[model samples]
Target chain A: MTADLLQQTIWLAAVLFAIGFIGLMVRRNMLFMLLSLELMLNAAALLFICGGAVWGQADGQVMFIIVLTVAGAEVAVGLGLLIQLQRRCKSLDIDRLSKMGETE
Target chain B: MSSDSLLSLLPLICISVTIMILMLQIVLVPGDRLSYWLTVIGVVATLWATFFITPLLPQQATILLTVDAEARLFSQILVICTLLLLPFCHRIPTARGSSAEYLLLLLLTLLGALVLASASHMAALVIGVELISLSLVVMIAYPFAPQYSTALETGIKYLLLSGVASAVLLFGAGLTYIGLGALEFSAISQAFTDIDLMEQGLVLSGLMMVIAAIGFKLSLAPFHLWTADLYQGAPLLSATVLATLAKAAMALALFRFYLAADLAVLQVINLGIALLAILSMLTGNLLALFQRDLRRIMAGSSIAHFGYLMVLLVAISTLHSVEGAAQSRALLAWVIYLVTYLAATLAVFSVMLHIAPASEAFHQTQLKGLCQRHPLSGWVLLLAMLSLAGIPLTAGFIGKFYIFTEAVNGTLWGLLLTLIAASAIGLFYYLKVVLMLISPAEGAEADPVTGRWLTRLPIILIALFIVFVGIYPPSLIDLLSQL
Candidate 1:
């Protein structure tokens, strides 16, 4: 029963990862892309918790906590930056930030 | 059990204490320079502590952290770089007002990076990485100017990317733990030997994802898009720190992690890394060629340099010869390359800060008539640029020589060729900067900016070190081999 649950969790994480990857590739809006990234992180967190439970070890759980702390810090800094970007460019289009061009 | 092991931890403790004192001082005395002095004293003390403890460190201290000679060497380099960077924060107009706050963030970042240099476990690695990243966010956005929106944007992009990378890292850690049932690097290595190929694949994937996350931090090719904007937008002092110190720490962490992993597994990742290195080299150099902004040019060049460092990584990964001498040579080459790269980069940025106007425009025009107006600064810039371009008798050339020699000795002929070609391409832009320095000003008068002793001291020291290392790299090579 526990193995079945672990397998289910892995499948769910795979699904979430696929969804996030799709959103990252398809979304033109920067905000949506960022949201997609957050989804991917959430999937990773879920995977970590499930792995810890399945393995019955504290390492995965410790890593999960570390990931959570990093995630929180990242959001704080990233959102702050986004606000500044929005103020300057007036739009959050990721595609438009190609001012530093491939050749230039 | 040994006194050496306890003594080895002094630098970390000193830095921690310094940070606490500075934090307390900031709260106690709102407008005093005590916090600044304490921070400077802290960095210097850390440097001194690194020197004193180097002899007492055990061959290999613990699972979570190592006190090996290599780690000690790198720690000292980091502390000295931090010390040199302190006074520039004072002269750099943009980093004013919150000087104490900036110093605190820098010290914290240094602490984290020092930990990263010594990290021997996945847990320590994760903690060290996040600590540095958090402090970096604050430093990047510290400039309160209205135009600092770019800094804010850069910070946000870094935050999001870093977040994704951390999650990826955690997932990798989870997979590794499941496969090996241990978080210790030594245990993981032992477990890999017993694991079947199919299980190895899963563990390899986890390692790859973790490498990708670190690749983002290092700004390697596919992961490099955020660097230019961030460098351009960040305050010059913070940008210098980011370009030199932070990247070095990330590289060191990745190097150590790879060292602990199985070579066969690492071989599987080499193809992808080679491609990334080649792409970063070509793209970085090519993009830098037409850049009008000096900061962007440095950013592009940095990407190219990272490519060179990746060449060393690829060599270290694939070379399986059991000859300890050959391995030590490779390690020595890597250390020399890092030290030379750090010095050359710091010298260039220091000169940039010296010459830059109050507005910090960093346009090519601002550098007009530099040779005529400030001969000393011009010569320093020229020497640094030449070194960066890997010219003979410069530290850059010696560093590149060692790396390429190792690559050739390891018979990575294709990678060696790529490095050579990319370096040839890189020469154009380094020359471009030099040309701009020597070119006559069209209409605008050259602005004279005199720097204080504290500001000039680091640049001069770095300049002399570059020359000394270039001419006598064997001394460093010998020191590294003893480690």
Candidate 2:
């Protein structure tokens, strides 16, 4: 039963990570891109949880908490920057925000 | 932990206390002058501890950090670079009302770099990286003038891309943890010595993900799309930090991790790194040739230089068993390369900032007949360019010489040839900049660059130091060997 759970968890985490990565690449909107980033982070957290369960160790759980904290910090900063970016560009498109490269 | 371990972490503790004090100052007085002096005191204390105090204490501060020689050297470099960068903060065209926050964030970023340079566990690595990148987000966008809108775009792009890279790095760590059941560097190395096939597969894939993420941070080719833009758009202060402190810390962490891991069984990963090195060297130099902007040219140069540093990674894996001396020398070579690279890069950026104090978009043409106007700036820029191009009788040549010798000893003929060719290509652009400095103005003389003596002093001193090191390579090699 534990073996089956382990196998299922691995697949689930991979699928979630892939979905997040794909979402980030596919979506050009800043908000959705941030959501995808959070999803990717959660996938990693899920893997940490699975690892802790399998190994019967707390290191994985500790790592999971760290990952969560980091994600939170990223979101706080990302969203703050997003609001400012919105005010400046009047749009949330990554392509439109990239006016730096062409000027050179 | 024991008193000795805590003492060994004096540098980190000093920086943290400084950050807290700066924060409190912000709430109370909220003046840039007070905050700036406080930060300098804090960083100087950290530097003193790194130089005098930490050396007397034990090396292992905890499982999460180790104050070994490499960490000590890197921390010193990071702190000194931070100090050099602080002066530029006052010159930023931001509103005077809230300039204290910039000093606060600078200290925070320095603390992060100190943590990263000393990281010995995966958790510490994650924290260190996140701390640096997060602080940088605010620092990059701190300039409030409406004319600097590009800073906002740069900050957001960096945030999103850095977020993805961090998640990818964590995911890789998670996978590695599942395979090895360990987070500490020593424990992971121990596990790698005796692992099953299935676990090996998991570990290899995880390692690849981590490398990719690091490569992204270091801005290696194929992952270097954002680099030139960040350099061009960032406030000059943040750009200097990004180019020097952040890259050096990440590269040091990557090296320590590489050395700690039992990499004999990871030949494929070494090969992958070699491939990235070749691509970066070729692409970075080739792209830098036609760049009109000084910052963008530097962005390209950084990509190629770090690519050359990747050769050390390959040398370690291949040279470990045959001759241990070669492996150790490779480490020495890395230090020389990094020290010279940092010195030369700082000089280049400082001169650029000195010349174009108010503007971010520094065009190459602005340098026309610099020798006639500001002889000091022209000479420093010329020498710095020579050092960067690895010309003989300059510091950069000594560094490249060491790397090339190591490459030859490790039988990395292909990488050596690539290094040679790319460096030749690099010389073209570097010399072009130098030529512009001396060549007569085509149309009209550019505005005279004006700066206080405080900035001018560092530029001259750095140029002289570069020349001194170039002429006396033995002194540096001896210093590195002693360390």
Off by over 4 Å in 1: A1-5, A20-38, A78-104, B1-6, B59-62, B91-96, B145-149, B357-360, B441-446
Instruction: List the candidates' TM-scores in order.
Output: 0.91, 0.96
Name the best candidate (by TM-score).
Answer: 2
Among all windows of 10 consecutive residues in model 1 chain A, the one with the lowest summed lDDT is A95-104
Q: lDDT tens string, model 2, A19-97?
A: 9999999999999999999999999999899889888998889889998999999999888988877886788887887
Give candidate 2's root-mean-square deviation (CA, Å). Answer: 1.8
Q: Report, for every candidate in turn, its global Cα lDDT versus the true structure.
A: 0.77, 0.85
Task: Estimate, for each residue in B174-225, the C-alpha lDDT of model 2 and write its tens digit.
Answer: 9898888888877776887587887788878888888889899999988999
Q: Weakest 10 consecutive residues, lDDT, candidate 1 chain B? A: B144-153
For model 1, residues B379-459, the per-residue Cα lDDT tens digits are 888889899999988889889898888898778888888888888888887888889889876765655557766678888
Candidate with the greatest lDDT versus the true structure: 2
Steric clash count of candidate 1? 2
Clashing residue pairs, backbone N/CA/C < 3 A, model 1: A78-B156, A81-B152
